[model samples]
Target: MMILVYGGSGSGKSAFAEKKITELNKSGIPLYYLATMQVYDAEDEERIKRHRMQRAGKGFTTIEQPKDLGNIALELREAKSDILLECMSNVVANEMFSDAISDPSIYDKKVSEEKSFDKYEGVFNKIKDEIIKLKDSCNNLIIVSNNVFEDGNIYDDETMKYIKTLGDINVFLAEISDEVWEVVAGIPVRIK
Candidate 1:
């Protein structure tokens, strides 16, 4: 079964997803926390640390797959397990922009100096494929994602494309998910 838990920023979505996935792991099978975050700065590092602290002693074997889901081939093929993908938003962001972010001359380059952002469709397809493969490998798949379309601010073309991809991914996941939940103000509201 695939479950999606989503909400706006700071809506306690991560906590909710963790608790739900832990509760679902009743069979004593290996509970894998497939984390997809890439630490880009000090703040990101702190956030990652906080998340690790939150899930400490939760019986999850953390596999940090920043962009490549196929990295953990042995875990997927060896046994059936429950996998909690910590967040899809990070996965999408990492896939779509990690190259530029990792470039040696990144700090010297300005936004206008870089190439145009043209990989939205490709990144979206890649993310969908990764999710499908994850579903095939895990017994229960719990995905944490952010609800990013509600803000009224108008964004640039690249930002808009990113937003659209995330929205599309959410719709696709919700269509196939056994349970879809929207966390609001620390409350989990079942939408499907």
Candidate 2:
């Protein structure tokens, strides 16, 4: 089974996703938490720490795969374990902006204008394919993503590209997921 949980920041989406995983594991199957956020600053560190505290004693074995989601299938020890991916926003950002996957020159104004934001379509397709592979490798896959399109503020070209890529990936996830949920103010509202 595959589930997608989405919400804006601080909407208790993670908690709700965790609860759903626990509920689904009635047979005591191994639970894995695929931590996708990379710590780049003190704020990032603090947020990761808080999430760690929240998952304490939850029987989850953490697998830190900030990029290359498909590679996680090789890192898992058990074949029938359930996996929860905390967020897709970070995954998309990591893949889209990383010097490893994308040329650093892409950010240069001259280069950006020449290449156009359409370059992100490749990143979007890569993420979608990796997610499908990961889901196929696990017994159950639960993905938590942020609803960042509601801010209603225009951003710079680079930021807009990242937002659009994540938004597209979220839509793809929702379409493929067996269950879809939107959490608002700690309430889990089923969307599918």
Candidate 3:
């Protein structure tokens, strides 16, 4: 079954996914966590460390993939593993905004060009492909993504474009997922 737990920022999607993973583990089902975060700064490093400690204590195998999740998903299929992807939003952001973070000058130039935002679509496509393949291959597939559209007001042109692309991707994924649950106040309520 493909289960998608999605909600706005701080809506407890990660907590919900973790709980489901724990329950699956207790049931003697093998659980593999495909983590897509790479710590690049001190804050990120600390976050990764905390996540590692949390999952390590529970024995969930973690495969860190920051850019190429499709490759990792392919390998997991060959290995025949059941997996959970903690969150897809960060993964998309990492791939879409990686260069921007390194080159601050790109954001400095106030150019009203759509070309600047083209990479987001490609990143979205990659994420979609990987999720489709993973869902088909795995025994149980659970994907968590932030339901960010409900609460945000995109004022800036660049930010607005990014949010639109992300919202479109999220909606597309929700359509394909066997079960879609929206989390609110640390509780999951099924939306589809």
Candidate 4:
């Protein structure tokens, strides 16, 4: 079963997703917590630490796979497992720079040739295909994602590309998911 849970930041969606995954685990398979967040700052580090604490006794073996999801199934061949993709936003953001399109910290005077739009589409497409393969490799797949499309704000082209790509991803997953949920103010509202 592919369950997709999504909401705004601080919407308690992650906790909800974990609970659902734990409840749906019937085969006693390994629960794989796919952590996609890249720690680039102290705040990011602390957030990861806090998430660890929250899931300390959840009986999950965390796998840090940020770029490639297809290889994840290869890592645990023939062993039945359940997977929970922590969030799609981070994965999308990391893939945006997967090709070294542009790095603000390293490149002061940017001179790149790669098309950001083409590169990002390729990244998203790969993620989509791998996610389908991952579903076949696992007993159940619980995906967590952020709902950032509702915010009314103007962003630069790069940020817009990320948002648009993530939006497309969410729509695609919603169509394929067995159940879809949207958590608001710590309350989960089932959308599908």
Candidate 5:
């Protein structure tokens, strides 16, 4: 069952995903949790560590991949493991330069030398392919992504682009997923 869950920040997406993982583990199915966050700060590291500890006794194999989810998915395929990609939004954010939005110069400066459009499109393609592969291979693949479309002025250039890219990703994943859910106040309501 490939379940794709989305929710706004502070809407309990992570907690819901963890709960679902726990429920799946109780059924004697092997569970693998794939986390794609790259912790750059002390707070982020600590938070991620706490999340790990939360699943310590839950019989889950946790794989932390900050980038290259394709490689991680391929490894899981080799092992024939049931995996859950906890989130995708962070994966894109990790691959993109941290200052890409704040300082467009980092990317714009390289635009002349390299086609930024093609580069980003390639990145999107790679991620999309991995998502499709995981959807096909895993018994229970749960994808957690943020619901960022509910607010903010999406007309701004950088923000609009980011929203559109993520929206495309969400739509593509939803099309492949067996179930699509949206969580609000820790309650999961099926959207599709």
Candidate 6:
């Protein structure tokens, strides 16, 4: 079973996803939390700490796979665990803006020029494929993703690209998921 939970920041999507995963584990399957956030500053550290506290005593074996979901699939191929990916937005950002991309200078130039979305097509497909592989490797996959497109503020080219990519990923997830939900102010609204 695959479930996708989405909401804006602080919309209680993460909490809802956690609870749903726990409820779905009546058969006592191994529970895995795939945390994708990478701490880059004090605020990030604090957010991580808070999330840790929130999921404490939830019987989750946390795996810090900040990028490359396919690698996590490989590592957990035998576990048959029920996995909850904490957030997809961070994963998209990590993959799209990673320093490991070949020819960072050229990539930056192309991104800033806003020439073509195809420049990010490779990234989009990589993330989509990795997510599918991860889902196939697990018993049940519950994904948490942020809804960041509703904000009406304009952003820089690179930031807009990131948002667009994440939005596309979320749409893909929703289409493939057995169940889809949008959390609003701590309420889970079933959308699919």
| Per-residue accuracy of model 1 over 62-124 as CA lDDT, tens digit each | 989888775553458567789898788888778777776788475246355654545677888
lDDT of each: 0.83, 0.87, 0.74, 0.85, 0.74, 0.89
TM-score of each: 0.90, 0.90, 0.82, 0.91, 0.82, 0.91
Better of 5 and 6 by lDDT: 6
Locate the minimum summed-lDDT window of 10 residues in model 5.
110-119
- lDDT string for model 3 (1-192, tens) is 777888886677777877775665444456788887766789988877876766666667877776667787677776556688877777777766666676778656534344655566787787788777777767777788886676646576666766777787778878887889989998989988
Model 4 scores a TM of: 0.91
Pairs that collide in candidate 3 are 7-147
Name the TM-score of candidate 1. Answer: 0.90
Reference-based TM-score, model 5: 0.82
Q: Give lDDT: candidate 3, residue 11.
A: 75
Give a tens-digit lDDT track for model 5, residues 1-192: 778889987787777777775665546566888888776689888978877786678677878876677777666675555676767888777665555645678767744463445556666787798787776666677889998787755474545555667788899889987778899998999989
Between prediction 1 and prediction 6, the one with superior TM-score is 6
Which stretches of model 6 miss by more than 4 angstroms? 100-115
Q: Which stretches of candidate 1 lie over 4 Å from their true place?
A: 73-75, 104-118
RMSD of 4: 2.3
Q: What is candidate 6's lDDT per residue for 135-185, written digit by digit as tens?
A: 889898999999889779899877898898998999999999999999999
Clashing pairs in 2: none
Q: What is the C-alpha RMSD of each candidate to the true structure, in Å?
A: 2.4, 2.5, 2.9, 2.3, 3.3, 2.6
